[model samples]
Structures are given as structure tokens and as C-alpha cells.
Target: MSLKSIFAIPFAKLATKKVYKWANKPFQTQEKVFQKLIADAKQTAFGKDHDFENIKTYEDFKKRVKVSDYEGLKPYVDRIVLGEQDVLWPGKPLYFAKTSGTTSGAKYIPITKESMPTHIKAARNALLFYILEKKDASFVDGKMIFLQGNPVLEDKNGIQLGRLSGIVAHFVPNYLLKNRLPSWETNCIEDWDTKVNAIVDETIDENMTVISGIPSWVQMYFEKLIAKTGKPIAEIFPNFNFFVYGGVNFEPYKNKFESLIGKKIDYVELYPASEGFIAYQDSQTAPGMLLQLNSGIFYEFIPATEFYDENPTRISIKEVRLGVNYVIILNTNAGLWGYNIGDTVEFTSLQPYRIKVTGRIKHFISAFGEHVIGKEVEKALKDSIKDTAINISEFTVAPQVNPESGLPYHEWFIEFENEPENLDDFTQKVDDSMQAQNIYYQDLIAGKVLRTLVIRKVKKGGFHEYMKSIGKFGGQNKIPQLSDNRKIADVLQNFLIE
Candidate 1:
């Protein structure tokens, strides 16, 4: 082992121990964070407007601040964009993470000096936790590549503005500088395809070990590597035994990824966002990511089923229950208060508060009063393909409310890397799994209100084409697992294999 790996092992142990200190007392850590956020921001514009000084409890906070989305917070953000100080946080934000918005064209999420370190530390600690648990730190000696957005930044009123991943690129620890792959010039290449090709050229001969990124985009990179060398990734980089991914669930891509890499490798899931780094997979044996209660953010939970209801019940982390889907809200040091980031999660373990991302608040199929979420569809597909040679490249589901024949149904658009031998049997297996998991869906199917889901074979590269057409082809963008409306389904029709 190299000198770096030798040092990393001990450091990983120390860091992980530090994490356990707070992880062991999740509620207390979160309470401290909550109090600090409220106290520190009380003099800021948002705090004053929300009567933060009078807020002494979670109930007081709920009464003072209304849960808000980006549109609701835009007025304050607009002031900050115009070079105003103390509009949201004290002074001005250190950076603005520019992200694609649903209704708003582009969203600029503030990253304050106080809140920025938590993002970097959380990512680092995730790997350290893995090393500590596995007693392996040798990957630290090999070249590590994180496939991400262009690191190029544009100045916005003296605060740098760029994609969250790009902003993160600037803060890679000095110790890892020698081991990090893809030169800065290559990372700055604006076109993703060109950049990925350049990355392949640069790392083809390196002793690469750790690879990290969204699974879908990494699959694209893996495909490019295989195409260029006529070898699976494992053959190309024998030391590549660790994968770190976030942004989307990895189950649907697992079989395809194994085929690409030619073996199963250790994987770590993260819950990082433009707003904050919320959680990370702390143990290989654990079911969910350990929520970052000690991070510079306070958490709130609103049950997903009641999210759209008027006067929805909002509670603190202490009140959250396992297995219940809740829309996560944030109150951060970066000056976001009662902010809804659109993600819904379920606590998988409550002892130390571990959560699994269930779905997005807006990404669900409820066209027929049956709220089928991303987790259900993903689980159903995952279960159906078990003990088979089937490999799925990508998939998405949408309601087919006005079908030409019989009853309405859910339409699943799937791109297969390896097609099942019997398509009809496979479809039945998936439908059966879906019905078993969701009582409402089963009820609708039993009542003959909806037929079994129809699977539309999408031509290879169809999802890629759809994303490209929509100007979100790569770098943190992903196809939603399910949608209530026909927006995505209507566009997908053009790519269906007839």
C-alpha cells in the first residue's frame, strides 16, 4: 500500500468515531442545530419577516413560518441576486448553486460560508465511514474520478454561480489532488459527450479504483470505455472496487452495471442536494443512509399523503415514525427556512434515524386516486427481474387514462440492455409485484377501473434522446421513475419501438 493509504486508514477510523458521537444522539444533535439556525438568522431579513425572535419551539416555528417552495422564497432570493446583504443570510452568500427549476426558469440556491463545509465534509465522511467499516483504505492510493458537471463558474454579483457538483469540484481536499483524475481542463469541457470521451482518454491507462457519480451517467461512461477498449470496466481497472452514487436509486441499473463492470462492487448511496448534504450510507449492512442530524441544517417532516392537504401536519425529527412517507423540509444556516425541496423519504431505521428516499413529492401516479410512488414502481420492476438474466437500461412510468381500448392503465416505458426470454411472463411478474405492494393499485385493478400495466419497449438510447431533446441530457439530470401526467409519456411515444 502507498503512504497515502496507510495514513487514510487511521484518519478514516478517527473521522468515523467523530461521526458516531453525534449519530448516537440524533435528536439532540438536530435540536442543537435547529436552535443555532434560529438564533443565528434572527437578525436577517427572512428571520425578521417570519418573527424568528418569538419562535421558541417547533410549534412556534410552524406558526411563524409557512412551508415554502422556491416560488414562495423568490422575492428574498431576488433581493440577494441584486447584491442585497442580509436578505436571507447575514452579509452575502458565498456561492449560488444554479439548478434547473420546474416552473421557475433557473433557481439560485445560496451556499453560505458557514454551510459550505458541511457539504464537503459529509461527502468525505461517507467514504471514510466505508473505509472504517471495511477496514480498507487502499482505494485512496489509486486514481479516483467523479463524473460530474463542468467546473466552470460564472460570477453573479461577486458570488460564484455554478452547478452544485461543479462548485464542489473547487474544494477537493489538497491531499487527494494527486489521486483525482480527469485534468481541470478536461473537467471544464462544456459538452458532456466530449468531456466524457476526453475523460476516457485521460484515465484509460491509470490505476483507477474509486468511481463516483449518478448511476445513469456513469453507465454512459462505462459504455464509452467498453466501446473504446473492447473490455469490461473491471478488466480495464482491476482495482475499481468502489462506486459512490446519489441523485437516483441504483436498483434499476444494478444488473446493467454488473454487466458493464463484469462483477459486483461495493456501493455507497448519498443524499446530497443543492440545498444541503442530508445523509450518507454509513454501513454496508445498513438498509438506509444515516441522516446528517449534525449537519448545519434542521429537519421537518410532513406526511406525503397529507402534503397537498390544507393545514398539513408538520413535525420535527423527534416526531417522525418509521415506514411513513414524509416530505422533508429544511431550515438551514444558508438562510432557507421552512423550505420544501420536493423529496419524500421513509425512515428505514429509527434507532439512529436512517432514511431512504421514497420518491419526489410531485413525481407520483395518482391519476386514478391510487398514489403509486417511485419506490413502488422501482421495487416492482426489481422484484420481477430477480433470478433472471434481464438487464434494464432505463425506465419511466405514466398514467394512460384515456386508452383506446378497455380501461385506463399505467404505461411503463423501458429500455432493456438484455431483453427477457418471455416478455409476457415478465410483464405479469411486474404487474403482480405492483399489485401486491400497493393496496390502492390492487383495489383499482380488482374493481376493473384500471387494467394491468402495459410495457412499451423503448428503442435503445430512447431515454437519452428524450433527455437531449429536453436539454437535460447529462450531469445530475435523471428521468423521473413515475409521473402523474402524460407530459413525459406523450414525448416518449415518438421513441417507442412499433
Candidate 2:
């Protein structure tokens, strides 16, 4: 065995044991963690303002701190960007993670020194779990190429501002550093096209075993690599075995990835957002990602249907029931208390707290009371096309509340690499599939409250063009699959060819 292989096996085994210990502790010591986190922040400006000292129990903490969104904490976050200390966290933020905003402009999320390890540790444990599950360390000896954002951070006000992936790249463990691909200089290039080309050149002939990135962007890189080398990815990197993906559902792109790589490889999915590393797929045999309970973040779940209610029920990890969609609220070491990160998830398992990301809080279609989620829409589309030859590139769904002439219906704009011969038949299949999965949708249809779904084929490259027009074409940018209204749909109309 190679020296690197020998070194990685023992390290992987040790990390697996440590992660298991830490993960299980939250179940038994959740209240202790709640007390400790509050106690640690009691002296901070936010803590003092919120009367944190008197809080003693989980109930007290919930009563004192209101569930909040970005707008609720904008003032504190704005002050931190100006290099203010102790406004939120104990000290000035080490950096800021810029993310897509909702009603407001770009959101600048603070990342503190104390909370940085939470992101790092969860990521490390995810890989370690994969290692333990496979009982293989040979891949660790080979290089891992993570498609990350530009490491060249921009100064905003006084704090450093950059993508979360870029910030995470800066803290990859020392031992793994030796096996990481793509030179640091290349990683700093802001232009994604140029950076990806540089990565292809640097790692094309290297002993690469693992590749990690958002699925779409990684697919773009794979296409470029194949174009440049004139060989399948399997031939270019024979050791490449693990495909680490997050940010979007991998099902839509799974077949394409396998076709490019020339084989089906072990896959790991991560449930990481700019807010925190929330969960990871721990077992190859299991279906859902195990929620990270002890990773410096306290989580609460409110049923998605009741999210906008004045006093929605907040569920603890132990209280979560399987098959219910919940909007996650986080209290993180980064000093975000009761913050709603806007993503929605459904618990798949209660024993180990496993979950599947269902949709974003804002990305749901409820016109005519159908209440279709992004997960449902995406799944329906995938299911409808499974037996057909259609290959989808990207898609979005919007509610057509007031059509020029017909009953209100769901409108889909899809960009296809290969389309079904009969568009009406394709739309029928998708509509039938959606009805099968969502009872509300089926009821609405049967009651004559809604008509069949409408399909509009977007021009080739329309989705990417729209993303570029908004200056967010690459690196963690994904089109919202479902919207409550036609705001995104209206914008997408500009990109659709007649």
C-alpha cells in the first residue's frame, strides 16, 4: 500500500468513532447544549438586549427570542460588516458569507471564528463517514478536486466578503491539503470559466479519486474536461470513485454524470447552506441524510404549512415526526438566534434524525390551494420523463393565476437537450404524476378549481443565460424550481425564444 493510503485509513477510522460519539450526545444532552450556547453569549450586545441572562430553560429561550428572518437581524449584521465587535457574536466576524436575499438585497451573513469549526467539522465527518462505510482508503491517497468559488475575498465595509464555499476552502485540514487538487493561484480566479479551465489543466493527468462541487457546475467542468482530453473521465482519472454533490437535487443530473464518468460511483450528498452545515448522508445503505445535532447549531422545525401562522408550533429533534414538511430554524454559534434560513426539509427517519431537503420556504406553489412544493414538482417531472427519451437541462414552475384565456394552472418552463416528440403527451404525464404524489393537487383538479399544467419549452441555454444576466451564473447559484407567484416566471419569459 502507498504511504498516503496507510496514513488515511487510521485517521478515517478515528474520525468515524469521534463523529459517532459527538452525534449521539445531542439526543441525551440537548438541553445542556441549549444552556451552554446561551450562557456563552450572555455578555454580547444582542444577548444583553434580549435579556439572555435570565433565560434558564428551552422554553424560556424560545419565549425570549422571537423566530426571525434576515430582516429581523439586518441591523446587527450591518453593524458587524463595519467591523463592530460583540454586536452579535462575542467578537467581530472573521468574514461574511454573501447569499441570495429574499425581499431585501444581498444578505451578508457573518461567520465567526468560534462557528467556523462547525462548518469544517461537519464536512470532515461527512467524508469520514463515507470512508468508514466503504472501508476503503485507497481513494484518500489520490487527490480530491473540489470546484470552489474564488478564494480572493472582497472587503465589504471593513469585513471580508466572499462565497461560503470559498471560505470553507481556506480551512481544509492540513493532512488533506497535500492531496487536494487545483493550485491555490487558480482557485483565486473570479471568472468561473477561466478557473474551471485551469482546474482541468492542473488535474487532468493527476491521480484524482474524488470530485466535489454543485452538480450542474461540476457537469460543466466534466464536459470541458472531456472536450479537452478527448477521453472519457474514467480513462483520464482511473482512480476517481467518489462523487460529492450538494446545493441541488442530484437525480436530474445523475444519469448525465454517470454517462460522462463512464460508471456508477459511490455518491455522498450534503445538506449545507450558507447558514450552516446541517446534515450529511452517513450510510451508503440508508436513504436520508443524518442531521448534525452537535455541530454548534441548535435546530427547530415548524411545519411548512403553518410557517406563516402567528404562533406556529416549533418542534425539537426528538419531537419530529416522519413525513411532515418543516421549515428549519437555527440558533448557531455565529450568533444567529432563532434564524429562519428559509429552506424546508422532511424527516425520513426519527431514530437517527435523518432528513431530506424538500424545498425552500419561498419556493412553493399554492395558487388554487394546491400547495405543491419544489420537491414534488421536480420529482413529478423526473418521474414523467423516466420512461421517455427526454433529457432535461433545467426547469422552473410557476402558477398561472390569471391566464389570458383558460382556467388557472401550473406553468412549466423547461430547457431540454432532448425533448419528447409530443409536448402535450409529456405535459399530461407530468400532470398525472404530480396528481399521484400530491393529494391536494389531485383534489383541486377533480373539483375543477384548476386546469391541467401548461408546458413551455425554453430556448436552448436559456437558464444559464438568465443566470448570467443576473450576474450569478456559476458557483452555488440554482434556479428556483417553484415559485408562489409569477415573478420568476415573468423574468424567465424574457429568456424564452418564440
Candidate 3:
């Protein structure tokens, strides 16, 4: 198909009626989820909305319910599991997606049957769109390689709670679920040391097509895949069509993956959270596809620009303006209602409500008043080694004040396969990128006061193995991009420096 016909979009025109329906209907569904939360939140959340003294109507619920993070909602989740209809998604506990949250501590996120339909609808819509864009939906539908965490949800005790992704994995259409592809659990979960060894045996036989997962684990597997196959990745899986990833950005991973595969793996953005599977990339560059099931969420926005301290300028879904950087706030079924998802995003365009996820609200290095966001850190890393062919699999940034120097500088611990040429020069270039973006760091870099950032290289699968050791596998939670305090920082510090 020609670019004119294929890329043609009068999206506003195409989404005319549909767009109106989406904006308006979602608010109503949000209202239903809020009813239970509004009553339950009365005791715990203090103020349910951001600033409202008391929650009354749907609007009041939006006003009174403070935009909350995962930590804030734990009490309500406890109330919910005890048989309170705290948030009104459909069905029983079925199971909680076993997720070790960033701040909520180790916990189970409820996934209800009532709201699960939206997850299926949203995931399907994302897939349907990729097919429709190509005009041939079934062209590459032979086998799907889901690089997912197959963690069994365990209760407080050590027994296997059940596989989290297996909930949707088993529910997948039978015929399409092929025997050739490896089941996510077949030595996949980062469990015993034997699991990784088992994965090598099970996955080596089949040629894969589409691959999906977070970038950190995917790169880990690729290293193993390369070592096992001995041949280039393309030769191992010539049928590969796309690399669909959620939880972290894919811009940097593109070149390395393409180089490995000997072809460009089409990149697809996925927004899967412990709360629920949210948005996805409609086309590679269509700003991200909104989940078709927002009808079940009462969505709100908190401007990241306004997140000076903990307080943020909150706006309701209908009240949201375009081209604004805001943290995602949701009132969803299955317990969490009127909650701040702790993610930041901006609307690229409207009609279909297209948005760009800027970064997570809390996942930035703002400790030193520089206000460095995840997006900025990504840019800095990309520019640092512009000439070299090194791609970062996973990285975390922390604003550390050297006890002797007394100057706060950002410490970036990046995971790469091997060190690129001119490591010192590469670090300098990254400093240049940082100075250009963050003022405080810029001053330090220009004055030569910067503590000369440290870059440590780890063994190939170290990060992957680390995550598994903690019970955070492929299917569990978002990669820890930017941690808040020293608790996680200490854990990361032991492995980072020489």
C-alpha cells in the first residue's frame, strides 16, 4: 500500500462520533466505580479528592478524593478484600496480579471480572489497529512470543499464589495459542536457578515472531538467545514482525534490537500497570492508543509541572486540556478509586485523545531542585554516546550529595552488554546533555565541580537475575526507572559502583 493511502488520517473526522462517545461515556463509568470508593474512602484517604472538603456527587467524588499513589490505596485494598465493595468493578477476587509495587510494599492488585472486559477490549483494540494499519490483520499471526512474567501470585506465606499473567494467558483464544511457542511458565519466572536453565532448553527449539515484554528482561533474554543459538537473532526467528514493550521506553532499544535481528523490529508501546492494562501504541508514531475500556475508569489529570511537592493541580477528565504534562489519575474498578497512577503524560492531539507518556510522576531526579524527569534522563543517555553503538537495557538515576563535596549530582547506573569505546568521552557527552537540560547540573558540569559521574558495567544477565531474586519478574511490575529514596537506592548502590 502507498504512504498516502496507508498513513491517511483525518483522525478527527474518523473519530468524530466515536471520540465524543469516548470522552462522555468514560466519565459515567467512572461514576459507577466511584460510588463504592467514595463511601469507603471516607475513613482512610482523609480527603478523597485533591482539595474538596467532602465528596458528594460524581464531580464531588472527583474533587474530594485526593489523587493517590499505590501506597495511599493499600488500606482501601485491605478493606476491599475483606468483602467490602469498595470499588465497583464486576466479579469476585478471581485473583490479584502478584506485583511487588514500588512503594505499596509487596502486595496483590485486584483484577475484577467487571472491569477486565475493558482490559481485553483495550488490548484487542491495540492489536486490531496494527493489523488495520497494515491492511492485513492476519499476515503475521502464526505465533506470538509473550515475554511475560509468569509469577504465581503468592500469599503472605511462601506457597505459589497462582500465575498472574496466566489469568489472561489461559483465557487467550485456544487455536491462536500455539504449541510451538513456549508457555510463559515453562521455566520462565525468575524463580529457582533452574528456571533460567530450563528456559534455554524450552525456547531454543522454536522460531519466534512477535515478542512482547519490558525492555530490561527482553535484552536479558536476547543475550541468552544469542549465546544459545550462536547464529544471529534473525536467523533464529526470521518470522519476527514486531517488538511490543510496556513499562519502559523503547526508543533506545530500537537500534540494538534491529542490529541483532538484522531487521527493524516494529516498536509498539504498551501501558500495562498493576492497576490494569491501560493504553497501547496504535501505530508506531500515533502518540499512544487509549485503552477502549476507559469507560470503566473515572480519569483525572495532575499536572507534573505543578507537582512541586506532593501537591499537584488536579483536573477531571472532561476538564483536561491538550498539550499539557500531567500525572495520570484514575478511579478504577477492583478497589482503587480516584487514584493518582504515579505516571506523567501529555496529550499529543485530541480527536482520538492521543497522548505521549512523558514519564512517571515520582520517577525523576528532583531531589536537588533540578527537576530532572525520566524523559530528560533518557535524552541525556541517548546523546552521551551518540557515536558509539551502546544501548542501555535498564538504568536508574539518583540525586546523591557527596558527603565531602556537599554538592548534589545525579548518579546514573546504566546496564549495557559491554562498555563502548572511549568510556570517559562518552561520560563527558552525557554530562553535556544533562547540563543543557537541567540548570543545577548544568552549573556543576560547566564549573568542573561535578563529581565525575560513575559508570559501572555488569555481567550480561545481572540486572535480570537481580529482579528475579526480588520476585519482580517479567509479568509483575514496572521496571524501577527512578526510585524515590535511599531504601531502594542502597540496594541499587551495592551493585552499581566498583
lDDT by candidate, in order shown = 0.93, 0.85, 0.61
* Residue ranges of candidate 3 with Cα displaced over 4 Å: 1-58, 84-91, 102-104, 138-141, 151-163, 184-193, 291-293, 308-311, 321-323, 403-408, 443-452, 465-479, 484-498
**Using alpha carbons, what is the TM-score of model 2?**
0.95
lDDT of 2 by residue, 68-173 (tens): 9999999888788776788887888888998888688899998888788888888877887887777787887789988988777888767788889888888988
Per-residue C-alpha lDDT of model 1 across residues 458-490, encoded as one tens digit per residue = 999899999989888876788998999999999
Off by over 4 Å in 2: 156-158, 387-389
lDDT of 2 at 261: 88
Candidate 3 C-alpha lDDT tens digits along 1-498: 333224323332353345346545655645565555555445433332243236667656644555556677777566555655433333345567665555556566777665556666566556655655665533244456665555344453222244456556655655455633555567345653355456556666665666776665566566677878787677777777777777776665665676667766677777866576667777665666564335356567777877665666666655677867788877665556666767888776555566667787767765555677777777778776456678666667666665445545566667774467787877777777777877876666567565655555544555655666566655445455665455445566556536
Scanning candidate 3 in windows of ten residues, the lowest lDDT window is: 4-13
Q: Is candidate 1 or candidate 3 better by TM-score?
A: 1
Q: After superposition, how far is residue 379 of candidate 2 from its true place, in Å?
A: 1.7
